[model samples]
Target chain A: MAKSFRDSLEAGFTITAEIPPPKSVSFPKSIEVAKKVAGKVAGLNVTDNQRGMMRMSSMAFSHILLGVGCDPVWQICCRDRNRLALQSDLLGASALGIKNVCVMTGDYPTLGDNPGAKAVYDLDAVQLMKLTDGFSNGKDIRGGVMKNHPDFFVGGVVNPFYEPIELELLKLQKKVNAGAKFFQTQPFFDIESVDTFLEQAKPSGAKMLIGVTPIKSMKMLKFLNENVLTKPIPDGVSKRIEFASDQMMEGLKISAEFINGIRDRVDGAHIMPINQVASLPLLLDMVEEGNGA
Target chain B: MVYNAPAMIITKKKDFEEILFAIGDTRSLFLLGCGDCATLCKTGGEPELKEMSQKLVAKGIAVTGTAVVPAACHELDTKRVLRKHKDEVDKAQAVLALICGAGVQSVGDNTDKPAYSGCDSLFIGNSKRQLHYYEKCSACGECVLNDTAGLCPETRCPKSLLNGPCGGAVGGKCEVNSENLCVWIDIYNRLKKAGKLENLLLKISAPKDNSGLAKPQKLELKREPGR
Candidate 1:
């Protein structure tokens, strides 16, 4: 029997890595990286034209990963395609045996390589989730048409640290109503902030997968805290990275330990390493075997 | 492309309130912002312009009528806005340009009443920075992007030379121009490199309806849902 999503997560701590697509078709670095994490991790995510940079399309690249024995989660963003394109892509992905999907609203193109390129936001992430579920029920978003549709185990993203967590939770409810099966969040270096988000979002009844990317040093912690959104490295998490003689190992240990701590709080942990995707297998091993959380 | 660059067409509550104060007791005014071109320009979308006309009511001017019609320049849209407000516009001391020339004149065509340009008519251009401006597309009698590798010859090229490679394009630097690409040279090398020298030989469509000359052109995009 084909493995189900619940079973896939139950096979132990689910570790997913994000592999960004290359700038163009001529580049092979992205493909090379996808193959690197095939059997070692649970699934590899292929981002479509991340940050709006033109790349070999995500559909083609995710199929490439599937060919290499890796389960790929294709990110379908609404920044490029309309409802027709978005629904068509979702239905097509199901035919190709790509089951997992991560829905994002996508960053503006003005923040991307081609700022001059037009951005087509047919539906936002929450709206898209609802749109797809409606399709599965043999209905359209506007309830005007009915057609063949495929079942998608769609995922949504949230930042636990966004100010006014209440508002974010309200949006999360809408996303769940749209038919999100699972949710993988932005990083949670600060357990306190994430814990607050968990309290607010726990009611959505989604299979929650909290993100836990460990830091390397005090400097790295500060950079993420100040520069990145809703990702502040708490003092306790920072101290683990600060005292280690080997920074990289310390980062893995801290990340693994953090995931183990809240292992009961959320269903899975998506280990996102800025450069350390290769460290994922070892990190998961530590999470399952270690006594520390 | 992506019009992500933000502009402030909205006056703050304080500023707009003050505008109401300035026009106190002014009545029977015709305030028209173009429905089509101004909508595209983002200066006066129908929603905001409607709000503006509605707000003008406090000063005794009730813009009870509004027309979100096509091309303020087109006699159709202009006539609609004016005729709908004619009694009001005729009774009023002034008519307002919610749109560009085509709209203002449409109102002016029937009345000896004064017309005001509420929003400045900025020629088709791009904002250089927040609140900063620069002219880009001049609607020169030609569009040379096809030959110039998607760059316009009149605006970007130093000399507006259609055929010859301008010397200003040395090392990709425009001679008389500061940092912008030299249009003709870009065209010459682009066509030559793309093996499309014949495309450069092909004449381009002459710029038309620019300078607000002649009548305004109309564009309609129909989206039949679920197609």
Candidate 2:
């Protein structure tokens, strides 16, 4: 019998892997990736147009994951949908028996393939969590009574490395107050920073899943360091990847080491093998090997 | 001493080619300008009206005449002004309004002739300097400025996130538009200065009540009964 995602979080540590739904309706690649991490992971997260590039709806793909006997964490972003559409979809997902939801304020449409598309951020992430809480209480955002309500294990994303850590902590506490059961952090390469974040975040009482992205190649490392990261990528970590003969393996090793080091300190680890789906199981194996040693 | 730019309804001139296409087959045009916001925006000022008249003439179209009305959006004032230029208005096949959409619509409402807008209504903004405008309000109906220490996250934040920064701001700059500093970060600093950081740290701004924007909204001030 499969343990519910909520149960997995409450009982002990858990590992979740993110699978980006392919743009086309026929997603053999997503299915293949899901199969690769099926039981090895505690849950599989289907990205909702990750980075605003249009893909199959997370709800639809999550149903597919459930059909394949995998616990699906359906991520919903506020960038593309209005409150009406968001509420309707949340109800629809409930009907379909999908229980886990990860709410995010998606990247702006201008950053995606369709720059001209309207960005409908009707509700920010905290508000979205509040709306979901409304559902659990048999009500809608407007205080209208709902005929049937959903029992969702709501989760949200946080950036432990975000500067002025106070602001991030405030939002984290808000998410917890808004009924977020768990949180997934943005990718981090340093344990010292995670320690600093966890020290501040522990009181919030939401299960924390520290994120680690296995840098596939030198190109990906540069893109993340230059564009995505708020702080400079640690010089020592960057140098190790830069000098390594096999950058992919070296990247995986770095992730394995980070995950192994932080295992006891955090609730779990969320491996964001960004488009490097095949490397996920191998990364997990490396973590297990380190654990054994 | 500090210099503050005038607050006005900002507009941008549409591409000349697109304007020409919209005014297709009209051989003569009465070029109209607005003296208020349009003039401040430089979209429908007297100089712009003269420049447009010259451009139309170069295209072999007849320039009937031109007027820079005090306020093209003022229906009664515009009607009186057009009546003064009755001969010019009658001779033209259509009116080309180099103003915001409201002014263009007002021109059409005042005159029987077909009126075309030469400028796209951008936003209600204040200029930082000449030709440099920034949007100060999105008119979201419900205001969150009191909680945000007067910085409007709706109009300023690219994501319009009411909680706090969305983990995208780095070095006090927005991820969507790096040229602009993140509004939430600015709000944080301002709130900190005001010793009201708890407004953000403790309060979660609810989802905006957008019912006020459900339709073309209207507000009619109640009249005094025997006035």
Q: lDDT winner among the candidates? A: 2
Q: Clashing residue pairs, candidate 2?
A: none
Candidate 2, which segments miss by more than 4 Å at Cα?
A144-147, A291-293, B1-7, B223-227
Tell me the tens digit of each residue's lDDT in model 1 across B1-227. Answer: 22345332321122465544544555656666655556656555567577777667754576635545455666766676566766766666676555655466666785677665555465554555544444556665456565557766555543333333312133444444446654544465566678765444333222122344444554598999997
For every model in order, the TM-score on chain A comes to: 0.86, 0.95
Interface RMSD of 2: 1.2
TM-score of each: 0.57, 0.96
Q: What is the model-wide C-alpha lDDT for candidate 1?
A: 0.63
- Across residues B16-49, which tens digit of lDDT does each residue of candidate 2 receive? 9998999999999999999888888889988999
Query: Model 2: how far is B101 from its true place, Å?
Result: 0.4
Q: What is the C-alpha lDDT profile of model 2 across A139-194, one tens digit per residue?
A: 87779998769989899999877767787788888888898989998888888988
